[model samples]
Target: MRLIIAIVSAISRGLGVIAALCLLSAVLSVSEMVFVRYVLGHSTIWQTEFTTYAIVAATFLGAPWVLIQRGHVNVDILQLAAGPRLRIAMEVLAALFSLLFVGLLAYAGWVHYEEAWSNNWTSETVWAVPLWMPLLPMPVGTIMLALQYVAEIMRLFVEPDAEDGASRNTLFSDTAEGTRP
Candidate 1:
């Protein structure tokens, strides 16, 4: 279980780095486009499409890393009020729910990718980029997110007493004042 979690974490971190690079590339591309269009008085073609796809890809690719890091926003008032057992139960339920939701999304995304790939679909733009290129990240990210959910569920069972700083501060502690532990 620990090995599985470690591997998943490593993969998520790698994807996160790729996502960051995608974002940087998008920014640079857009800047170049602007410079070419306005400064050089030239028309741009691919930058808009490339930047859009890059941003979307970055969002999907980075989601699993956010989940693994507990960076997603959560209103944890109920968690703060719950007892230890109830908290554990709630965490399990949340993880299960996330797994189900993300799993379904991953499945759907794969189906979409398959259809796009088989049909040889392309964007109706000047660039005519392959649809599968952008679609690939959706399933990949959601699958990683589902795995992260599994790891969360496993952790709840394996180390019930373990309290990470994010959970301790955001869920249980008073945010206005300071952390509990």
Candidate 2:
């Protein structure tokens, strides 16, 4: 279990770097499209669709790391006001819920990927994206998400403060102090 969690965390972090690059690529593509359309008076259909997929890829790829790092925004007003033990209990419940939800998503995505594979589906767009391309990311991302939550739950028990000072927590701290954008 420890080895598995370590591997998952490493892979999640690597994917996050890829996702960052994809996000930059997506931004550049959109900027190019805008320049072409507004300044050059023409835009390629592929550029728009490709950019959209890049953004999606970036989002999916980054999701695991975000979850691992506990970067999701949480409504903690009530939890914050509650006692430490209550807050810990709430976090555990939330992590369990996340695990269940992501487990379902991963299973569904696997089924979808299998069907797509059997049918040899492809995108209807002129660029012809293989259906597996999008579907592959779904299961991969959701599984990563589930693993991260599992790791978090484990950390809550085994390594308290593993999630302390997480990225979102920092953001929330800034917001609480009226220093956030």
Candidate 3:
């Protein structure tokens, strides 16, 4: 279980790096586009499409990293009110629901990608970029998120208490009040 979690963490971190690079590329491309269009007095074609795709890809690819880092927004009022055992149960339930949601999304994304690949789908733009190129990130990201969710659920079972800082960090803070469970 520890090995699985470690592997998933590594994958999520790798994807996070790729997502950051994609965002950086998007920013640079947009800057270049502005310069070329305004300063050079030339019309840009691919920059708009490329930047749009890059930003969207970055969003999907970064989702798992966000989940692993507990960067997503959460309403912690109920958690704070609950008892230790209840808090653990709530966390497990949340992880399970997240896993289900992401798993379904991954499956749907794969289906769409398969269809696009089979039909040789391309964007209806001047660049005519392959649809699969942009769509590939959806399934990959969701799959990684699902794996992270599994890791979280496993941690709840393996370490019910908040002694394991990694597990606590993902679900809750290490403050005295927060570490009760």
- Per-residue CA lDDT of model 1 for 1-181, tens digit only, reads 7788788888999999999999999999999999999999999999999999999999989998998889987778997788655676777888888789899999999999999999999999999999999999999999998888887777665543555433422333344333334
Model 3, runs deviating above 4 Å = 159-181
Candidate 1, residue 34: the lDDT equals 94
Q: Per-residue lDDT of 1-181 in model 2, one digit per residue for the tens? A: 5666778889899989988998899889888888989999985677787787788778877898997776887888987886445566788898898789889988998999999889999889888878887678788888888888877766655543443433333322334432334
lDDT of each: 0.83, 0.77, 0.84
Worst 10 residues of 3 by lDDT: 162-171
Best by lDDT: 3
**Residue 22 in candidate 3 has what lDDT?**
99
Model 2 compared with the native: what TM-score?
0.78
**Superposed Cα RMSD, model 1:** 6.0
Lowest lDDT sum, 10 consecutive residues, model 2, at 165-174
Question: Which should have the higher lDDT, number 1 or number 2?
Answer: 1
Kindly report which residue stretches of model 2 are placed more than 4 angstroms away from their true locations once superposed.
Answer: 1-4, 35-43, 162-181
Question: What clash pairs does model 3 have?
Answer: none
* RMSD of candidates 1 onward, in order: 6.0, 8.2, 4.7
lDDT of 3 by residue, 48-104 (tens): 999998998898899989988889887879987886556777888878887888899
Error of 2 at 108 (Å): 1.7
